[model samples]
Target: MGMSAGYELARRGFKTLLIDAFDPPHPNGSHHGEPRLIRHAYHGGEAYVRLALRADERWLELEAAAGEKLLERAGVLNMSDPDVYTFDGRLDDALKLGVRLEMLDVPEIVKRWPGVRLPDTYRAMYEPDAGYLYSERCVAAYKKLALKAGAELVTNTFVTDVKAENSIVSVRTKDDTFLAGHVVLSAGAWFKTLEPFIKLPIRAVRKSVAWFEPRGTLFDAGTFPGFTLGTKAGGYYGFPNIAGAGVKLGRHDTGVEWTPGEPFEPFGAYPEDEGYLRRTLETFLPDSAGKLLNGAACKYELTPDDNFIIDTHPHHSNVILAGGFSGHGFKFASVVGEIAADLIERRVSDQDLRLFSVARFAVAR
Candidate 1:
């Protein structure tokens, strides 16, 4: 996400400098997974539909520029009970916005996609436009482009403080100081620690991802589209083996609490967390859960309402903050990069950012 913003800024001729505490595409940060779900019919809200739509174009543009496949057109199936949040305002709004989608009964979903079984009561909304994003590849591409665009790339640099005076923003690292017309805090989970801090309603929770060998052709890409399971007992979401290792499954809410610098090793794959995911798979599609291959841990910067905080600091206008994505923000990284660029350029975007403003959190904007 950092590289996305940085590259966009550099591309816009901002003399940008991209800094990272840890080298990206590395497990030290949140975005390490092979694929992240990209669904336009967002369960979060309809306001995100336009942003998601714009992001799709950016993804294709990045893919073309990188000369590599960064997004898969596998489609996405949002399975849920009729009354669940996924089917209500979120899907309804997408429909109103002219997003293409198909409603499916349990039998229809199961019959059409023989990879898994759906309960009789389960319903689904299939977005043929939805698919998966190659997170690691995208970050790598962004970093490469940023450097090629003459943006200074600094890695292993620890940003200790950010101070704004008048309209100038000074970013101080452990070893050097740099100045910029504006500062963007796309620092992911660590944004809470920055100076002149805008108290983010973000909780960094440890999340785990597991891979399982397919029982049969059920996990084949031709049959299994990327899917989000919205069951009664919470849910899990994943993609097929397009990028190739095995099928991936991640529990949305089944994460452990951990702070920065804490060891994620001991906490990942805890029995209960695994049990919850395993139980869900067992109930819905046992064949897909037979053999677990590998698992790893990541973090989610969750907001109270699970929305993002993408706005300038109320007290410190020079510092722009973008964090608290819950877990579904990666797919929108493309448009978000442009949004951050706009903020840095001090342009008022036609897109309404009220839902993501810092003022929404009662932070005196």
Candidate 2:
């Protein structure tokens, strides 16, 4: 979010400076994993549909400008037991926005992807236009573009303090301090450090993802699509094997509490890291659960409601606050950057941002 916002602010002729604790595209934050799902048919709410459509346009534009592939049109399949899945808003939003979605029965799902083995009670929704984004590459692309657009980037530095008073925003590190007319605080899990400036009810949670060697080409990207499955056990999401990277899988709900400054434990530090994923794979995608290829751990900054916070400070309006994205925010990086720029420049965004306001949280101070 910081990288995207920096690029937009710089390209729009605003003197911009982006500060980070570590070099981006690194594994310290949530955007490090290889691929992030990008689906337009949102189960969260209808408000996200328009932002997602705009983000898709911006991502394609970035791909064209960078001369590289940042997004893959592999499609996305969402499957669940009829009794467990209750988010009908996904279909409603898709239909209203003219998104190409197909409702698939058990037989149709099995016929299309022979590798999948779901029970007769399972149903699926397929979005032909949805896909995944190359997360690290997207950050690198934005970093390059932001620099080329004359934005100064200070990497490998920690911001110790941020003070906004008398219409001037001051950011301080261990060695020096910088001042700007406005500032965007898009810190991911490290948001707790800035509580002195403004308080928000956010917590960091540790999550893990693993890649498994597939049995055959049945789970390859060409034949299979990115998918999400929900059952009585838990919710899981995965990607088909791409360029021999293996089938990537991750659980969406339930994670251990993580501290902001502590080093993230390795993927196998806990048994459930691999155990739960293997169990999920065996139940739904047995063909792709041959062997564990690789694993990674990341952090999710979650709000009380698992929604995002994209609003200006309650008292210090010049200090924009954007965090608490939960687990689903990478695909919206492009438009969120644009909205941040809009907020700084015009004090308003073209999109309806009431859903992400700081006022929504009772604990926000």
The sequence of per-residue lDDT tens digits that candidate 2 reaches over residues 116-233 is 9999988999999999999999999999999999999999999999898899989999999999999999999999888788788889999999999999899998789999999999
Q: After best superposition, candidate 2 residue 190: deviation in angstroms? A: 0.6
Residue range with the least summed lDDT across 10 consecutive positions in model 2: 86-95
The global C-alpha lDDT for each of the candidates, from Candidate 1 onward, is 0.79, 0.92
State the displacement of the C-alpha of residue 228, model 2, in Å, after optimal TM-score superposition: 0.7
- Quote each prediction's TM-score: 0.95, 0.98
- Rate residue 140 of model 2 by lDDT: 98
What TM-score does model 1 achieve against the real structure? 0.95
Question: In model 2, how large is the Cα lDDT of residue 94?
Answer: 72
lDDT of 1 by residue, 130-219 (tens): 888889999999998888887888888888888788888888898899988788888787766673455666788888887767677777
Q: What range of 10 consecutive residues in model 1 has the weakest lDDT sum?
A: 265-274
